[model samples]
Target: MNEVVHTSPTIGSNVEEIVFVIVVVDSTDRERISVTREELYKMLSHEDLKKAGLLVFANKQDVKECMSVAEISQYLKLTSLKDHQWHIQACCALTGEGLCQGLEWMMSRLKSR
Candidate 1:
């Protein structure tokens, strides 16, 4: 029963039956991160998605000015998501770093549920 749902921040309200959500954000962009966080909050706040798993992929970790995972998590206030399961991962998609770990985490969480 592994199910994944991919959607843009704006259209999340249109989807249903979401077991996992992969939220990718640029580590250096505060504005984008803020918007993404709000969107994610709204989506997961819905009653239907209360148990959905969230994987916040902090992209562009290779960039020198990128923010740390702790900073991003604080900025996004991920701790406030008390009703959902979520994890943050620092990743560089171009070099394929940290992607597997995030996916594996999501898989393990889903399996546990």
Candidate 2:
């Protein structure tokens, strides 16, 4: 619903279930947004949500037009996430690279719980 690229309707029957929320961000204007890193942390740090957890797919990684992980992390101040299992991964959906790893990490996190 929120400018998402491909949204599969998962609100239904017998799916394995999604335990984590995957929050996407604009690799460019990280500063202009209010509901960015802070909101993500709020979601992840919610008392009830602590176990459910979450991940972030920093897509558009292959583009010369996109921000690097170091840059994005600096802007978001994600050093705290390193110790936590906040899976922030570099991905290029255009080339289908790193997509499986991102999804695999999500599945692993869910299964591990």
Candidate 3:
């Protein structure tokens, strides 16, 4: 399993080849989501990573006030990533809901590539 664990907003410029990038965000926090969008754009804009696949996981769906996938997508301005292949999935880590679906989606996209 190829994976890149990012612990900071400043992604390394040394990234060589990336198969897929999973961006996990808290659906209940609007401010964090916005920050995440900025970071995502910065990371994806790197010349070496432009073709990498992206999967945005809007987690914490179990929370009553959490944003839906559509809302998260809208706030993230995902449409701006028209040149990249991306998908947003609603998920709840507590119950493992939507986790497999998101992974499956990523796998399918990877296989197609």
- Give the per-residue lDDT digits (tens) of candidate 2, residues 28-95: 55565355867877876776566564566777776677777677666666676643566677877779
Q: Clashing residue pairs, candidate 1?
A: none
Q: After superposition, how far is residue 16 of candidate 2 from its true place, in Å?
A: 11
The number of the candidate with the highest TM-score is 3
Q: In candidate 1, what are the lDDT values of residues 1-113, reduced to their tens digit? A: 59898876774465435487788989989767778778988888888787888899999999997999999999889898887789999999999899999999988886775
Q: What is the TM-score of candidate 1?
A: 0.79
lDDT of 3: 0.86
Ranking by lDDT: 1, 3, 2
Candidate 3 Cα errors over 4 Å, as ranges: 1-18
Candidate 3 per-residue lDDT, tens place, 4-53, comes to 88686766676444467889989999868878888999999888678878
Put the candidates in TM-score order, highest first.
3, 1, 2
- Rate residue 66 of model 3 by lDDT: 84
What shift in Å separates residue 68 of candidate 3 from its native position after superposition? 1.0
The Cα RMSD of model 2 versus the native structure comes to 12.4
Model-by-model lDDT, in order?
Answer: 0.87, 0.69, 0.86
Candidate 2: worst 10 consecutive residues by lDDT?
26-35
